[model samples]
Target: MPELPEVEIVKLNLEQALEPGDEVENIEFLSSKLRTQLCLPKDIRWPLSINKLERRSKYILLHFSGGFLLSHLGMTGSWRVEKKIKAQKHDHVIIRWKKGNFWIYNDPRRFGVFEFGVNTLTNKWLAKLGPEPLDKDFDTAAFLQSLKSSQRSIKVLLMDAKVIVGVGNIYACEALFRAKINPFVKARGLSSKKLELLLSSVKDILQTAIKKGGSTIDSFKNVSGEKGAYQKQHLVYGREGEKCVICSQVIRRKVQVGRSTFWCPRCQK
Candidate 1:
C-alpha cells in the first residue's frame, strides 16, 4: 500500500514529469462507473494545464489550470511514468501529455479511484482526514488531545484516520516498536511522555520510509516502475517469530482489528 510518504513521492514525480505549462493532450477513461457510485462521466474531454501537485494523507491531488484530478492508489496500484512501454493488464487509466505518456492509475485489486472535477480538491473524502504525521501541525500535544477520550487500543487509535492521517499498518508496527509501547495498551492509559515518544516515532518512521521510497512488500513502485527499497529495512513487520532487532526477543504477531500487529514483547510494554 502507498502510505503518506509514497504518496508524497508520487505527487512530486507527477509534478516534475507533468511540468507546469504542459497541457493535457487528451484524457481517456478505461472503465465505466456505476450509477450508484455517484461517478460523473468517466470519458470526457478536459481542457487542463498542469498547475501544481499536492498530497494529503495517501491521496494525490492534481490542481489543473481549471480543475483538479484526485487519485487514490488504494492498494496494489501505482502511477508509473515511462518513456515507452506496452500497456499491461492492470493499467486501468492512462494520461497522454505533451512531454510523454504517463501511465496514471494501475491497480490490480481495483480499489484505486480516479476522478475529475472543477475545484473539487476539498471534497469530503479528503476533508475528514487528520493531521499528517510528518507535518509541523502534528505535535505531541495535538496527538494527546486527539486520544484524550479514546479507550481503544493504542494501535487502533493510531490507525484512526481522525487521529492521524497516514500511519498505515507497516509504519504503525514500526512506530509502536520504536516507542516501546504495547499495541494493546489503551489510548487513554498512556502517559504524556509515552505519547511524546509515540509522536516522535511516528514522524521518524514516516520520514525514514519516505526517504527509503516506501515499503513494497508486494507491488508498490514509483511512477517509474522501480520497486521501493524500504522493504529490506523493515525491522519487525512481517518478521514474525524472528528475533527482535532491538532486544533479541522473538518478534511476535497478533491480529488486531483484522490487521497483523508486530512487536517485541521484551522491548515494547
Candidate 2:
C-alpha cells in the first residue's frame, strides 16, 4: 500500500495532471466484480468542476462543487494520466475530463477504495486518522508526551496510525534504523534525547521519501507511471543479513504486527 510520502506524491502528480477548473465528463466502473467494493453516491451528477485536491492520511480527496471523491490506493493501486487512455485489463475506474483527458485507476489486487459523497469530514474512513507527522501540531513536546504514554515498542508506536499518520512499516523501520534506536525498546522507556532523535528521523525520512517519489517495494507507480527511486537509498528496511551502513553490524529482520521490520541490531542497540 502507498504510505504517506507515496500518497503525497500521488496527490502532487494528480494536481499536475488535473487543474481546479477541470470538469468531470464521466465516471465509469469497468470491472464486472470488484477487487474491492466501490462506494459511490447514487446521485452523482456529472460536469462538476474540481475545486481542489487534498490528502488525509493515506487517502486522496478531490473536492468538487457539490461533493468530494475520496480515493485510497491500497496495495497495488495506481493512477495513470493519459491524453488518450488505452485501458488495461486491471483498470478499474476511469474519471474522464471534458478536455479529452483521462485519469485512470489501475489496481491488480482491487484492494483500493473509491468513495464518493458529500460528508467528507464525518466519513468513517477519515474519522480515526491521527495527526500528520510533519505538521507543527505533531511537534517535539506533543510527540514526547504521546511516546511516554504508550507502552508499545517504539517501532510499534511509530507504526500506529492512530498515534501518527503515514509512518508505515517500511518507513518506520527505516526511521528507527536511521535514529540508531532499537525497534523493540519500550516507547516510554526512551530518554528525551532518544525520543527527539526518533521524531526528527521520522520527519527527515518522510521528507526525503517524498522528494524521491517514495519507495517502490512492489508494483507502485506514480500518476506519470514512474517507479519510485527511494528504494535504492534504503538503509535497512529490506536488507536483512546485510551490513549496516553506519556500525558495520549485520542488518536484521523481525515481524511486528504481521509486518516485516528491518534494522541493524548493533547500531540500534
As a whole number from 0 to 100, the lDDT of residue 262 in candidate 1 is 94
Q: Write the per-residue lDDT of candidate 2 for residues 1-269, one digit (tens) a residue.
A: 78999999999999988854679888888875454466556787778789899988999999897778889988989998989989688998989999888999998998888877687667888877778888866667877898899879998899888788999988999888888889999999889998888888889999999999999989888988898999998999889998988888888897888888898878888
lDDT of each: 0.79, 0.86
Question: What's the C-alpha lDDT at position 18 in model 2?
Answer: 85
- Error in Å for residue 30 of model 1: 1.6
Clashes of each: 2, 0
Clashing pairs in 1: 80-223, 81-223
Off by over 4 Å in 2: 32-36
- In candidate 1, position 267 carries an lDDT of 93
Q: Tell me the alpha-carbon RMSD of every candidate.
A: 2.5, 1.6
Evaluated at residue 110, the lDDT of candidate 2 is: 84
